[model samples]
Target: MVDQSHSFYLTSSLQQKLSKLVLAAFCLFTLYFWPQRFELWLIQVVIAVAICSYFSYTIYRLKSYKSSFTLHSRNLFKFANNPNEFECKVLWVSPLLCAFYVLPNTEVEDQAGKSQLIIVWRDMLSDSNFRHLSRLLLYIRRNQASG
Candidate 1:
């Protein structure tokens, strides 16, 4: 069985649908504009490379930390709690505007006996941010005196 203390929430169906719509719009725009300019093509290629690098790094970091959570699930939880909470603080990492934030959500019970804390973000936090957030959560969890 999966570790209950490390469980991550799942994204809602509506949020998933909205994400697809936004992705479609972005792809349409890219397709329309990408072929028009040689300079734009170069810029787009550079941007694509940067984005890929970011994602690769993020994924590597996430794997190293063994994160069970995903961006979609985090966003869904955030939306359910307070849709406006992410208006200013969140940052999108994907072309489709997949967001990243440091917002808190409801504690969830995993298949195991322990409870899990949730942190929502677009992709994942930076290395420093991740460390800080983890430390903060550890402190909180310790003080809470409950798993």
Candidate 2:
């Protein structure tokens, strides 16, 4: 199904692929530095393995976060599985990539909105949807600037 101008869905495969790429890079880095120093190399390998395990676990936990998102008027957005809507503010923008991260419109802030960081990577979205979302995000930014 086609998403509206204000709505977009994230592809799980893309997310998983990106995560795998990162994990693979870490693995490759460790392998590339393989040395004959058994003691030191073992310690380095253990540390690298630990870091990769932690990162994989974090990604698994974040799987619970909603994958679908819709932008409502007045800078409000709600996740598909979530009913409540929260006001959002643009945290960063990349005109070239039509990508950005949004934060909750609140006084207190953390890593991201209650769950995950709202980052839309170019590859995560289709060209048309990305263009529409880019325009919508621009509109939201303008409202923020004017008010």
Candidate 3:
């Protein structure tokens, strides 16, 4: 039985990071660049409050939970193929809608001969979130080949 455990890291490209920074700067520029727009200042205040509240909630939930909620794949081999199979499990911070997901090795094949065991975190949170997760999964698959 081959027991291989790996931590998949989601790495962003330099271009991606630069684009994010640019977008953030643009938002900040719009918010603070103009000092005379009283209405715009009020809107910016509301936006800041909303952003703070969201982060506070996310942090609180992360700290308060004993362990992350997990969801196992019904059919592990539906995504991969192997002669000897293993079981995969996903640890998630949120129930169904979140960006953070962790996959840990569970069990390797003993005497039973299986093809492949796969545990996948399906982030069907939203179109954009799901797209991000899908990209992560692709990276994991590519890294698995090299590792």
Candidate 4:
């Protein structure tokens, strides 16, 4: 439903980077100071894995976007070469890290299907594009609420 074309990039602002760094530091500190308990160790491992995965995905998204199609519509579209169109749901929107979501359209059989895609502030979204996205999301929410 969107006419404005926007490109995607693996970018983050200084504020975002600093916030993430602080979070990582806090996790690391906990891992180092917490007592030598098995449960604590497990928690640390999980946190570390999550942190690594997030960073890895960020890099992967950028590289993939380089070769994938550009975002031109507000509806579901392919961001990669994969022959699948994604349906998006706006979970949350913020200046730091907006929670843009997408799910597969072929998951009609699945009972639980949800995927999150985060859009950082430094991404290539222009002011007009962001406004359009926000407006589209609001419209979707309104329709869903009514029906």
TM-score of each: 0.28, 0.62, 0.31, 0.54
For model 1, residues 1-147, the per-residue Cα lDDT tens digits are 111222243323333444445654565456556667777877776766665565555444443443334222122322333332221123323232233334433343222332223334323444454444343344433433443
lDDT of 4 at 50: 85
State in Å the error of residue 111, model 1: 32
Candidate 3 residue lDDT tens string, 1-147: 122222222222333334445655566566666666867778888876665565555444533322112122221222222243333323332333223223323454353443333222332133454444444444444445555
lDDT of 4 by residue, 3-60 (tens): 5544443333454555656766676666677688987888878877887678656555
- In candidate 2, position 129 carries an lDDT of 77
Winner by lDDT: 2
lDDT of each: 0.39, 0.66, 0.39, 0.56
- Model 2: lDDT of residue 122: 66
lDDT, ranked from best to worst: 2, 4, 1, 3
| Model 4 TM-score relative to the real fold | 0.54
RMSD of 1: 15.7
The predictions' CA RMSDs to the true structure, in order, are 15.7, 5.7, 14.4, 5.8
True-structure lDDT of candidate 4:
0.56
